[model samples]
Target: MEQRLASPLLQISGLTRHFGGLPALDQVSFQVAEGRVTALIGPNGAGKTTLINCLSGVLEPDSGTIIFQDRDITGLSPHQVARLGIARTFQNLRIFPRMSVLDNVLCGLTVQAGGSLLEALLRTPGLRHRERRLKLTALEALDSFGLGDKAGWPAGALSYGDKKRVEMARAFVSQPVLILLDEPVAGLNPEETAQIAALIRQMRVYGKTMLLVEHDMDLVMGVSDHVVVLDGGCRIAQGPPDEIQVNPLVLEAYLGRMSATA
Candidate 1:
């Protein structure tokens, strides 16, 4: 069955990035439809991470354009991108081990935290009210991710699975329009993988647009409404998951390797 994609929320046209004269992303282009899960899949070194970095403004593209919400955002900074309603999680966990879970989630609110320095210094009534409201919102986010009880615990004290949930809660706390998830299920057990897959679906149900780079074919096929395949830093195939799964290029470049390794 063909998947019906929503209107395009993000458009990448001729996005190229290089490291040391080698193209990490060579003219890659794709559209992420609004309110859908778009999976970017390829073998390692296929520019998946580079594309994600470029979209999230961690690295500027050497050439090409990135359009978000119909705005030209090609070279925006990470904070600028975040303030414009895009949030991302890292391939490697970026949690603050020493900080409390609630504090860690609060970090995401910086994009929405608006106040003058003098107002904060004086702790005005409005500032206090806003702070309280933000804290409540953070607590609600934790509760949604099933970490409400551990909100006061040191982030490092949680188990690996719980830590992953904490990262998810923090990334989503700010309620960004688009979420970039990079290898969201890396190093998880089967149970944890299933949990994360369900969470991904839940996010879509709530109307969050997502673009994820992942190697877990099962999770990708299970949750993705649209799939884009990249190989050697170029887009090779893209479409519904069923079509992408049988694509000759994808089979030769991605799944064939998994079959051989297994």
Candidate 2:
């Protein structure tokens, strides 16, 4: 495999998140390289979600600098960050259950549409053309995720794994430069997990950078080019899979508890 050299797509410096008096994330910092999959792994309650939430503007960090593509976006709103091409899928699936899969994906493209609510309601000529293009794009995204055939189906009718896949399709429909995936393969069977992993690898080929917060060690170790391990809201280790797998701190953080039980 040929390696591509590119600058970091995301940079975090001294990021801290606190819930009242308890700190969930403490000055955590890392960089997500362009066109590469960076895995964020940690034991439960290690603040992975907190960090991601702050990065995605779901939560505001107390103090920190979040730079994307060299622009400071530390306290930007979620909508603001998203408009800058930073997209994310939640740890819990957040699809519109009552909507069709195609419509669910089409929501991602609404940011690019040009029109007021009245124009959209009236189906004006310009808005109609834009809607047609968005639908085509949404369909293409679904096809890429192997869900094109189910485009018209209600999202709630899909299996859990399929819903997860649909969420991924919706996130990518916006053509984001950086995508944060939170436990994307959670609750998936082996086959579904494998498919999701493959899809993640494919994203790299498509030149989309990924920051994956996943607990499945096999998937993280197998597909990630770099991995960051967190424990108790602090970074324990960060390196390639080969190094992360053997780091004593990482092993101690995850496997040490198992050993204590044993």
lDDT of 1 by residue, 116-207 (tens): 33454455787677777888999999998889999999999998888888888888988999999999999899999999898889999999
Tell me, by lDDT, which candidate is best: 1
Q: Write the per-residue lDDT of candidate 2 for residues 1-262, one digit (tens) a residue.
A: 1223367888888898889889898888888888889999987788999999998888999988999999999988887888888888888999889889998787767653433334534556776667887889899999999999999999999999999999898788889988899999999999999999999989888888899998788999888999988888888789889988998889989667545544
- In order of appearance, the predictions have TM-scores of 0.91, 0.91
Enumerate residue pairs that collide in model 1: none
Worst 10-residue lDDT window for candidate 1 reads 112-121
Residue range with the least summed lDDT across 10 consecutive positions in model 2: 112-121
What is each predicted model's overall lDDT from 0 to 1?
A: 0.87, 0.85
Error of 1 at 148 (Å): 1.2
lDDT of 1: 0.87
